[model samples]
Target: MANFFDFGLTLDLLRLPFVQLALVVAVVLGLLAGVLGPLIVSRNMAFSVHGTSELAFTGGAAALLLGWDIGNGALAGAIIAALVLGLLSRRSSEYDSVIGVVLAFGLGVGVLMLYFYKGRASNKFGLLTGQIVGQDFASFALLMACAAGVFAVLAVIYRPLLFASVDPEVARARGVPVTALALVFAVLVGVATALGVRTVGALLVLALMVTPAAAACRVTASPLRATVLSVLFALVSAVGGIILSLAPGAPISAFVTAISFVIYVVCWAVGRARGLTRA
Candidate 1:
């Protein structure tokens, strides 16, 4: 059995270039998830995020099969899915069903693409789960650029988006362009989800994108405080997960999800205690 607490091995792995790059990727992913997660939860778009990630996986798989850039493909696939969902489910009643239909189709297509690809098993596996070593400098650069773009776009629309998310009817009455904001926000989420799929894997991207924000919301009602706490939680989960996985040589997503869930549990306990004290 491998020693889970091998400090020496952990230190050695940290010293390698790929591992260092992976850490940077995790940081970027954490920040992106943190910034967008609260909005996703507030707007009840968690299912939409999942659907976006699945389409991202499909895009990544298609990229592997076609010998193209996985990140680019994933981004394209995710945006398309977001647009489709947005257009089809303009009514709140149809939202969940639209996501379900798109998710199922995207997953089936992703599976078919993976089946046809006879390349490295790790590449295919990484689409569903995650692998860090495959990220070279070019891919890293692309990830950085995409992250910057998402941040810039969010900066321009954050207030309106938040307003729309919290109360769409009121926001629309105030001429906030709620529908346009929703479409833009969905695309932004798709971009973030695509970035996360590369680090946390499509199957478990929710740990970073939703769980941290959910935990933060449980403890705090203030939007700014929730965003801050969510970022902190996501950073700890992503970076800590990578560090812990180093010695054990385990999948990063497993550790990431585990740490995220633990944080959520702790926050839940604290929130429950507070509620009881108030009562």
Candidate 2:
């Protein structure tokens, strides 16, 4: 019994600098994505999240070329892309059309930047798959600031945003500015996407933002409960994935995605069993 309980050796890695940084990264990304993800999924903007993340990839890649902070670069890219999408598609019902055009342009730009970059291969690869374990204190601090800003804005706009998301026509009929809210939420989602790309990489940003919320959605139709559960699921996936990555050769994103997928599957099964699933 004593031998079975002896688990001290495996816990030593938690004290390492890199591990600590990764944990912080995981927490910030988890909370940010968790908070914004339900809103995104509710509005059927999961595709938009991917589109914005790819542009964020372009921005981060360009930042690597110019020797700037990749997170900030990604943030810049997401904001620009989201605003452009919102502004251009405000009066049009063909948002998918606009997103498709932007996605192509964003990917092309990212490829061009990667083509010309003379940095270490890991630096370029990190934009696609993340490199949070190597982050410094300054970067960590910057991440905290970004997280704070995202949460602050969310706190201010959560209720109206929820109303707008659930029913844009009803929200507008009740005097809510649906268009303005959409633009604001788009910017917020863009910021969250940039932060997600920083930790989970461009290729897997949606894994964190969409999967956990989707899983939560499957289990509960109550928006409040669903959002809370989504946050919990994201926290588990992010932190659990980081912890699992303490093992050699384990990629954090892979673990995170797997955990999220498993959670989604479990929730789907449960929802089906309870007749919570409509179809």
lDDT values for all models: 0.91, 0.85
Cα RMSD for candidates in order? 0.9, 3.5
- Residues 28-127 of candidate 1: C-alpha lDDT, one tens digit per residue: 9899998898999999998999999999999988888999999888999999998999999999999999999999999999999999999888888877
Q: Worst ten-residue run, lDDT, model 1?
A: 126-135
Candidate 1 runs further than 4 Å off: none
Error (Å) of candidate 2 at residue 219 is: 0.7
Best by lDDT: 1
TM-scores of the models, in the order given: 0.98, 0.93
Candidate 1: clashing pairs of residues: none
The clash numbers for all candidates, in the given order, read: 0, 0
